[model samples]
Target: MMFNKLFSFFTVFLIGSSICFAQNANRLDSLVTVLENNKLPKNEKIQLLIKIAHNHTNTDEGMHYAKQSLQMAIEINDLVLQSQAWEEIGTIEQRLGNKNNALDAIFKALHIYDSLNLKDKQAASYMQIGGHHVGEKEYDPAIIYFQKAEKIYSEIEDDLYLAFVLTNLGEAYRFEGQLENATTSLTKALELNKSLKNDVVEGYALGNLGMVYAAESKFTKAKTFLTKAIAITNRLQGAYPTCVYIAALGSVYEKEGDFLLSESKYTEAFAMAKSAGLKEQIRDFSAVLTGFYEKHSDYKKALKFQKVYQQYQDSLVNRENIQKNEQLKADYEVSKRESEISILNITNANQKRWGIALISGFVILLFLAYLLYRGNREIKKSNQVLSDQKELISKREQEKALLLQELNHRVKNNLQMVSSLLNLQSRELTGHPAREAILSGKYRVEALSLVHRKLYQEGVDTKIPLKDYIQELVLGLFEGYNAEFEPNFSIADINIGIDVAIPLALIINEMVINSLKYAYDGIENPLLKIVIMQETKEDLHLQVIDNGIGFTKNDNEKNNSFGLKLITSLIEQLEGTMERINTKGTHWEMKIKLS
Candidate 1:
């Protein structure tokens, strides 16, 4: 009776597997027919190729089709299509048990998707990476990536993809022994899929939930959920999830002391996995059967199943070795092709250079002949014309200089009038908050006016003498603030263009104002020193030191004020860096790079 029952079960299983295979074959045939049209657009062809690859995911044909899609995508320079192809290739590699290669391909896809800012595609790649990590029994990283995918899917409001991520996340959590989290994630995924009417992912979530319950020793719940999961997975999904659900059901039965039913379910799942050519599942089930028989002291059956388990394990290792060898051969062929292309390019470049050289030599000879054909009178006339042009250019340059100086003088006068107006406004607003702000504006305007004043007074319009400019600016600040200390200057005899001079002057003005207003409070004697030295041909070092109280809390708060922000902007404009040291007093040092 038992033999007949087992035979009947095998027959039904084989028929169902055959039906699934036929459906896949029909799908592949239809896709290939669509792909055969040579007049199809490259983009459409790449899409079809990817679809075909997905259909053949269980075999090498999938990799072949994926690579074809990648090549076509590259030819058309379509980044999105290329990323999709790479993602398909990664899925195929993972199915083929090349975990490392799968990870590498998926990461390549993720990088491209990230660059293109495709959130959906990035989440998909993250899920793929998490699945690979789960396969390797590395649950921590698996959960991390699954959570990352979850976050993105939620942000995009993609409940369908979110359900898929949650299903995987729950499974990873179950494997890592976090049963509560596993149940929570799987339950949410189940509800999401049901709401979305996605029966496929719903089946996955149900199966994972069953596995989690089993791990928690809830035998009744585990069996109930596993049975329902098997019904849905077997009818809607395929051999993979159905086989896993069946194995979990068998384990639940064993825990409940139903030895006969447990053995039957294990044997059934193993046979189905073996018939489907799922080597990983086959090896796993065989090991389970081996342990089951040993628990019952059935040595003969235990030995038989143990040998089957070892056989498949060896087969997996040999397959990996063969894959490695094939990869090495492929790499060598690619390298050889690249070297041949490089040599051809060099030969073409040398030929082109020789052709250019011949043409240039002939042209040069013709030019010499032309020069000889000309008379001395023509040469004298050309020389006279050149001299006349030079004289005219020099006069124009002198005129431009005079005009620039006049413009600078007028700009200085205008800025002084603005400063005077600000002073007048401050007097009227005495005892008001606006008065202080107006005075600060006056000082900044004077700093800029000083730059223009130096440009108009100096012999050179573009360059300013740094030593003289700093001295006058600092002295003017002291007189404006009515400070009691005299500032010492140790400046380098350097010349700078107006671009650097204007910003530098404002920076000095702000720093001096900060020192006078904040640094010298509650001090008996105050000293301020300004130093500028040439660090290199294209670098300058500047120091502003004050012998008073160090940088206080008030100064820190002032750093966020408009004055400090303006100083920061000017420093950035000059491509310079500043460092503040509060030892002894407050020391501000800067390194400015000349552009």
Candidate 2:
């Protein structure tokens, strides 16, 4: 009972039976006794209350006791009692025709189910609330509630409850004029009830199925399903009373134009109502009789039954006003709670703002401090990087200067030693070839000396231009030979870096010596030419020409000439390629790539 009061209510409701008034009152009274004194255990008492609210009396006195029990259950804060109470409230509201209050109570129960994470409770409450709305003739809301409940019931493996809810949903849909949807829902409920051996749910489904067929104007289907429903009701032996079953069948017979059969059914329904003492169904019997007499075109009898039906309908509507007020009271209690929550929220928001502001200020200060520290470190690191880069540039420059100096010194000294050796060899010989070798070595020394001379004269730290150095190298070689040469026979204007000058001068010495000594060996006229130019930004082109007998095949005959070997080695070291084209004389071409 307490559980019902605490959490139940979210949907519309009722588990109705065509029970006699006396039996219904007795059942409600017994529920009150068990729930009032807490005679049963917590769960048991809650279940009892749910049963009473679902299948109890249809009287106002029954509702009053249920509400009291529900309130008491709420005070105890028991979840089961809470759910039961909300369900009872919705049911009572539905009976009283106060649909909104019924809806409100069920929603409260749904909120509780959400808190408790009880899927079954949620589903059951939805179905109950849906049923309540249906009673108020609010079929749309009723279908929504029942469908939600059916879905939840399916989730928890409660086939019986799921079928029950679906059957209710089908009824709602039927009343809303959706015969197809109604038929589908009822059929599904029928299958589920059959599986669970729930003949009551099955019978409800069958009756609803017939109602849908009737609404759709499918008389054949309507008759078949109603006949089945009648059989189910008979087997249940008045457990759900006989009046509704007889009335449903009578209505079908009238639709089929079977006056005698229809009359028989209506009489039987009236008899059952009298025996059961169910005031509502007894009143519904008058409407059934009216439909029968109208089918037979008995205007007087039809009008009488119609009047009786009208009276019954009026009383039902009048009874609902009481239900409406009771629901408003329930809603008032819920509104009170919502107001308390809103007030608490406002107070909490005000309190939280200061804490949030303090935390935000602290965070901002921490971030700013971090940024400042990082900036200072970054500045210091940038300064260090600049200092290191400058030092590296300076060191490389100094090392380059020293390297050029050492290389220049070694070249000058090595050439002089070779010159001295050549001189000694020349002195030992009596021929001109020995003197030519001596002169050639001396010319190479002169070419290297020019680089040192420029470094000293120009006062630059490391490098010297090769133009002046090459001119000096050629002049020295000519002077040694004491041979005349025109400007056209010279490459004196060639330019190169000091790095390229020494090797180029050495190569030139060999070429010039070989030509002068051999090309003019027997001839009187001799010619030589050299030219230097750049083929690309990173490449240099060199050419040498001689007007004399061309190179012999013996020149390349391997493993012999020291001059040729030295020339080839220097070409490799410079990463330059050389090719020869012979005509009247040798034409040598080279293209060198510079780093």
Candidate 3:
């Protein structure tokens, strides 16, 4: 199933490549014959050259004609024509597998189009650039460029080209595993092509939609769409894309558990691809068959197809290598010619400059010696000033650190005094409802006091190690409640600043108090677990679980409880969420966003 999905992705590029070079040979010949007329006007000749180049894509002849058209357009100062010529050159180079050169030429065309405000041509250039990105399997940039082209084509009401961009855009979405988006774009493309009566692009749109369905595992719909696509391509005699659709149908069959039918379809598609001389399709289908046979435990057939796949893979690599060698040779020739011209120019100029060169050299030496002496003197003065400034900055930083430490120590002492006063007040109101509230307030104050104490002792003013603080906080709660066992702790190593630490500490205090008071009633062995970890760079996950009597309906509905309200307020202040579960015990899960 995975192989089939990958096969669908690989064949989209093959389909695109085939469409590019599938022009009628007779039409190309007619264009060449017309080009033979020497009396043709320059502008008409330039247009003819571009047309011929488009028909000859993926061939050196196409590049030659494109360059010729570009030169003529430059001579006539026609920016639109020049841009069109560059677009053709880019498309041909891309089809010939020269990506960098392709992008360079396409951007050149885009620059010219932008300067001229040629919306239609600019959109076309964007589509070409998008197609290049798709060929490289870079779907993000491909989708971006395709959307740019889609917008312009829609604005211009160019339904034909709009369909083309939409089709490619849908294929890119499918490649990126965005099946719903792929369906949307392909369906729109299918409608546009139908309205425009463009059978070729219509077939492509249908084929891509089928692949999207196949990826989603909707085998019935997959077969339906792929069968329709096959019909269209078959009627149009599109052998390459037809074979691709057939292979996609085979994948659908494989996923549906129709092994015999799947094998037949795979073999049929392979035979058709081989007959059509589609090397990429042949290589891909060979691989698919290799996998299919291996799964069926047919080692003999698997080995045979594996060797065939390797052969075609090697052939494609060799073809790319040959193209690179030819490019290198052309570059070397150009460089050699440039070097010969530079040598000639240098030789002619050197014959008349010997006496002046000696005079300039002597003057330069004296100027260099004087500048070096001045540079040394300035360097010494700058170094002395830099040293003094550095020392002053260091002294100021130390003073600031000492001031922060003193402030934290004072704050901790003041918080401890407040807690002591709350404790005294709580003792005075014995058996009174207000005593509970005072004690809760005292605990909250202690939570904040711990944070400051940690800062003062650690001598770090800003952030505190939260795991150590949480351990101490939880241990203190257990001791305050006189619990029989310590709660399990699974805390990650995280440091947080005071802004987050204060509110987070208060939240934990409220939650632990509620669990100790309400949970663990009549339980033989109470269990408590506290988990704190960073779930992402900007989020922290905390879980406080206890195994005791679960919360009753009344407990769950206590929205007005002071402790519950306090917990909610602190969580809100921290920009966090809380979830409570009551099964065997109480479970408190919270995710806080870190600033």
Q: Name the best candidate (by lDDT).
A: 3
Task: Report the C-alpha lDDT of model 2 over 206-322, residue by residue, as the tens digit.
Answer: 877876776666778877887887777566543233456556666667767787887887788777665544445556677667656655656567667766666555555432454
> Runs in model 2 with CA error above 4 Å?
1-43, 49-75, 92-108, 114-117, 216-221, 234-242, 270-285, 294-300, 318-595
Candidate 3 structure quality by residue, lDDT tens digits, 333-379? 56546757999999878854764466566878757756876898799
**Steric clashes per prediction:** 0, 37, 0
Residue range 422-508, candidate 1, lDDT tens digits: 765676687998888999999999989999989987943699999999999999989988997799999999889898888898999
Q: Looking at model 2, which ten-residue stretch has the lowest summed lDDT? A: 1-10
List pairs with backbone clashes in candidate 1. Answer: none
Better of 1 and 3 by TM-score: 1
Model 2 scores a C-alpha lDDT of: 0.64
- 1 versus 2: better TM-score goes to: 1
Between candidates 1 and 2, which one is better according to lDDT?
1
